[model samples]
Target: MTYALIAFALVLAVGVALLYNKLVRLRRAVENAFAQIDVQLQRRHDLIPNLVETAKAYLAHEQATFEGVARARSQAQIARSEASPTDAPSMRALAQAESGLGAALGRLMAVSEAHPTLQADAQMAALHEELASTENRIAFSRQAYNDSVTRYDVSVESVPGVFVAGPLGFKPAESLLEAPPEAAVAPRVAFA
Candidate 1:
């Protein structure tokens, strides 16, 4: 009877240790995923200046648009640096800042469309292509981050983990950046 009790306690100890380690591993994965997002966001921010300068060369009359882009970019940089991707409030602020930057970029692109010369410029075309590619990468990174967060949250809230997580103070992580509502709906296309 004594040996049976000892064996049961030992098994329980091992189980708890394993679960704790698994929780820690999941938390680390979430952090790494968010780091990937940070890398892509930095790449996008770096490209913005070059893109803006290229547009400036041709759209000399549109000073205000450029200023707006600059301001938005600056705000985004601040938000990106100040906020952790796993924190809800900080992530929301970062998303808002990024949306503002996207809006500025869209306006610049629209205005550039009116200038045939700018459209024809090879440099502008190349910058636009790079920007598009970077946007795709950012999207992928965000998806990965969200997936990691989901997995981590599930582990924290499920089964034996539920018993361990609360005492360990393991809270669910926030999802990655979400698309702004204005950008969520597909634009209607009429072939007329």
Candidate 2:
């Protein structure tokens, strides 16, 4: 009877240790994923000044639009700096700031479209391409972060995990980024 009890205790100890280690791994992964997103967002912010400068000459008439873009970019940078990947309210604020920046960029792009010379400028073209690529990378990073969060959240919420995770203080994480609404709609083509 003594040996049986000891064996049961050992097995339980091992199980608890494994569960603890697994939780730790998931938490680290979530942190790492968020770090990647932060890097991409910083890269995008760095590129914004160059993008605006490249378009400035052609957009000289649209000073107010430029100001709006500049303001939005500043707000986004501040928001991004304040946000942590795992915190929902901070992430939401960052997202809102980013959305404002996106709208400003869209207006800037529209202004560019009006100027054939601006569109044709080699430097402007390259800047546009680079900005587009950075946006794509941001999208990819957001997806990866969301994927990691989903996995961690699931592990923390599921049957056995629920009991272990709560006691361990593994709170659920929120996804900060999402595809823009326009991305869900199919493009319309008109042939003249």
Candidate 3:
């Protein structure tokens, strides 16, 4: 009877240790994913000023648009600094800031479109292309981050993990991409 009890305890101990190790790995993966997003976001932020400067000469009269983009970019930088995959509010703030920046950039682009010279400027075109490429990288990073968070959260919340996670201080992670309410509805397609 004593040997049987010892063997049972040994198996349980090994199982829990394995579960703990898995959780640790998942948590590390989530952190690594967020770091990739941070790097891409930093690249996007760095590209913004060059883009703005290239457009400035042509957009001298569009002061409001320039200010809006600068302000949005500042807010996004702050939010990105404070954001973490472990913190939901910070992640949400980062998303909101990024959205605001995108809108501001869109407005700037629309305004710039009115200036044929700006559109034709080779420097401006190059900057815009680089910015677009950075945006694509950011999107890809966000998707990767979200996938990591999902995997971590699932492990933390499921099965025997549920019993061990809390005791081991493993908390669920927040995804970097939270779809806005508008995203739930399909877009209308019309042929005019």
TM-score top scorer: 3
Could you give candidate 1's per-residue lDDT for residues 1-192 as a string of tens digits?
999999999999999999999999999999999898899889989988988898899988889889988999999999999877457888888888988888787777777777889999998899889888988998898899899999999999999899998898788888866767885443332223
TM-score of 3: 0.92
The 0-to-1 C-alpha lDDT of every candidate, in the order given, reads 0.86, 0.82, 0.86
**lDDT for each residue of candidate 2 in 63-110, tens digit (9 for 90 to 100):** 887899899999999998898766889989888888788878877777
User: Which window of ten consecutive residues has the lowest lDDT sum in model 1?
Assistant: 183-192
In the predicted model 2, the residue pairs found to clash are none
RMSD of 2: 3.8
Better-scoring candidate (lDDT), 2 or 3? 3
* Overall local distance difference test of candidate 2: 0.82
lDDT of 3: 0.86
Candidate 3 lDDT tens digits, 1-192:
999999999999999999999999999999999999899889988988888888898878777878989999999999999998888899999998888788778777777766789999999898888888988888888898889999999999999899999998888998877446553343332224
Clashing pairs in 1: none
Q: How well does candidate 2 match the true structure in TM-score terms?
A: 0.88
Per-model TM against the reference? 0.90, 0.88, 0.92
As a whole number from 0 to 100, the lDDT of residue 87 in candidate 2 is 81
State the displacement of the C-alpha of residue 147, model 1, in Å, after optimal TM-score superposition: 0.7
